[model samples]
Target: MDHQTEVNVGGPRMRPVQERSDHTALVVGDFLYVWGGYRSISGEEIFFPSDEICIYDMRSGEWQTRPMEGDIPPSLSGTCGSYLNGSMYIFGGCNDNGHSNQMYCVNLLGEKYIWKNFTEGVESRPTPRDKHSCWVYKDSIIYFGGYGCKQIRDVHPNSFTIDEASWAVIGNALFRFWGWNNEVHVYDPCSNTWTEPHTTGSSPTPRAAHASATLGSRGYVCGGMENMMMDLHYLDLESWTWTNIVSQSAVPQGRSWHTLTAFSPSSLFLFGGLNLFCEPLSDGWVFDLETAEWRQFQHPHQDKPRLWHTACLGLDSDVVIFGGSRDYRMLMDTIAVLRFPSLGHCSDVLIFQTQPYSLLRLCEDCIGKNAEILEKQLSILPLKLLEPIQKRISFFRTAVQTDKKITCT
Candidate 1:
């Protein structure tokens, strides 16, 4: 096993350490909220403090730390979450103690944010687990797969339970360390109830550290840590069925802790993870939903290995990958912005005819004159597109007002 030791990477102001893995990052409006995850210092695993919230401005490429005020959960990593309505719903993660089955929500709309526990009195819920994946389908948050204890009750009528052979017995059967679970659990915030919906067809094997993303009415899952999986499957929210995508080429290999991000209606972006050999990966690929095909694409961070990282579709559908480990021994505090070509975006255009100051002034004047019209036009765009574009526009407005030379590439 590779050893881990903490480095003082948080700098002088001493905010929360960004060198983490298994943390959750979700872009809400103009900011990316990152929470949970852990790092090691002197061989001791240390979780990011639960008292502070880490946020990144999509427009500024800057980080902000704010005090967390709410029914805060313990510091945890391997937790999965989704942004819904005005709140961010978090479920299942592990800490020093053990895995958790609890569900909590933090309202981001309020001036004073408070974390609210939702599963406190719920008699039925998913088992305590970490490294699971969750998807927000309409009003419900659906989660699947993680390393946790066995489920005492049926999560679904036909919940794909773990096989007997997978369980590990310790101390003459005095205790049992459970294996991975492939069960799917759904939490409906409208009724505040948990239900397991029955589905047809084959499901992915019990696995953890998988990547999931939602597109339209389907939730797609790909590549996880059950001996490292390369298979891809998606659960149709409309039909409640699992459909597998078997491609002989162009797809990523067996890997874990990668990110699957749905950038467009017909495409998904996949990035860095740990391969079956437990080695960090740097390659990226795009999966086309319409054609059921995968294609390898070069990214800016192609040479930088990363696993246990969190990625979010940022401004103009750029994939923003935040803190994760480069290897088993070294975690990172860097953020890489990858603008994928699969989103039908034009290649970086270069301008050679104009002086920097004059071009900047032209842009500033145009934006200033059309500010109201721009706002009205952007109002009708979807949040995924609108938020990022607004951020970009704001960034452009700020950039043009400064003396810095603006270049696009």
Candidate 2:
């Protein structure tokens, strides 16, 4: 578990494992499954409304492709899918004509794909949507905000239980926050309901196209774009409230359309998306819940900057990041795996010498002048104020550089 080195796992050096062109991915068990998407063919970019499903098994380090059986749902992008209790449920993506309202389930154990049409009588079925997020919590599939024909709508979040086979909207009025409403909806099958708790202080501006993951009872919402954001937010299910956790080090840029995944209960990871300037990002970061801090992990062998990519937690403590759009013109098939650092062994550091020098040099190129001033004040004071000032300085640096890059061409 080396913290600095990045291993390729079993994918192409330049591209991710699966390279079809247009397809979105979902991960379940030990394998990553990708379905139909559009790609370039001949001279023009063509949409392949395909039922071809490809699987990359992490354990075996092999790739397998299979045609979806039965009447497959039309090929679409932005469709959300998740695995629960040995089944994968997919819902709501856009086709060539308009948004899709179809729901389908694949029984991983039974090896069968089942489609359910929810166009008829239902309390709500999430009006035609694509680019929304869906997660299986308890026994229900919960869906959040996405794009429709005209505008991106943050409709009342909806859910569908396996037993009832009907859609029900939740947290309609109790949880109200305005702006870009791309939320990650999680259902507690035990309560048979969905909850989006409110966050205190300044919440990450309402954003769509972000990513989220649940660890134990808490759900983490990270890197998304409203106008611009590089911060992280967490929803404590037990507390039913959102808390903006200040990042502790230099972090990735404010990005949307990225992926956040939970590998273990204490470890969360994020990778690849477009920044506020619409430039693609290829870096990665990890969050430690115990420390309540974020650490940027350098991937020495990662793919190029990309947005709209997908990532998932794999076996042992490995995270898999897959295909995404490099730019409007280029789509990617690159994949990278991140292994967590081992915390058991302690490193021995020989004490050298300590001296206080000009603090001005330390803060010379610092982004936030006010923050640097505070840091200088705290350094001379007691240790109690040092922690808070250090935290603020770290966050300021991250917020400034997350997407500010100087290109020398």
Candidate 3:
């Protein structure tokens, strides 16, 4: 990875010192695409350009900032996104103007990615919202709790359904001030329509910035802030039944803007968020689905606090967390990788075989000799070499810091 090389992909080259919060990151094949976030520099809050995307090639350890064309969404933050089929769908975020209920899709299967606005002419849709949670299950995207203005919109009465218990909880509050919601709105691509699914059992309270992930037929939601929520709930997609999880083991505090990622079929990794007092947290936990136990996750970067960051299941099931705020005032561009022994097949000692500097030199030699052939082949290089290349790149990023003083570790 060449941290020093700057490549322009139409328009202005993206800043290298980028900071973000309320962003979304999704791993597609070997590349991780990051989009829709805001950063606070000094006192000004600047949302990242929605026309551009930051993509990280995991195999090559390279970062690219490319301009996106065709029906790009407005510069916004706190939007929710999900990956389905060969495209990524983005929905509902707030910009400088206000909130939106629009939905857009970017086709990743094609060589030239094009964003398509699919929300046009949609009669029934969720109200404008942000800080919501969404996950793709089966052929539809399950959109849950979000913070949005309470506006009564006409819905398809037959399709709009809610559990009796959830209706009692939400009742008339669905049409009140800028409020949080517990609505289960399902968007089916086939019909390009949004329907409020009638869920059963007890539904969680209306909240925002909560984390959600799907494992098999179940969708799990944890930690959010309406009144600083700390509950855990899952809706069985097959049955549309909500079940609140009660853990015998100690669990992490209630938080909003945290992330819950399912690293495996039976387990999930939960990380940083804001507590009841709105303070950022750095703790990590792993929830076992079989036993319904919460176990503390031990890693080196526990002291690093982050919230509103995007965590994706990277190669080898490692949790790749990127760009969030530490204090809600100061945003960050830091990327942290957390490895759990339970999720990966390779051990730490064997993951990186040679020294960082040496591995990079060998890769450069391979590319120099065969250019085209080796450049493409570099992505498939042994994991032993790939790991250290990342470490080497990190050293380059951290050495200069903001002071520009090169410090050797």
Best by lDDT: 3
Give the runs in model 1 whose Cα sits over 4 Å from its true position: 1-17, 151-175, 329-409
Which pairs clash (backbone N, Cα, C closer than 3 Å) in model 1?
6-41, 70-115
> How does residue 163 of candidate 3 score in lDDT?
27
Tens digits of per-residue lDDT for model 1 on 218-317?
9889878654558899999878899888875666788987888888788888887878776778788888877878898654555467777788876456
TM-score for candidate 1, residues paired by index: 0.75
Give the candidate number with the greatest TM-score.
1
Would you estimate the TM-scores of all the predictions?
0.75, 0.61, 0.75
Q: lDDT per prediction?
A: 0.68, 0.51, 0.69
Q: Model 3 compared with the native: what TM-score?
A: 0.75
lDDT of 3: 0.69
Q: Candidates 1 and 3: which is better by lDDT?
A: 3
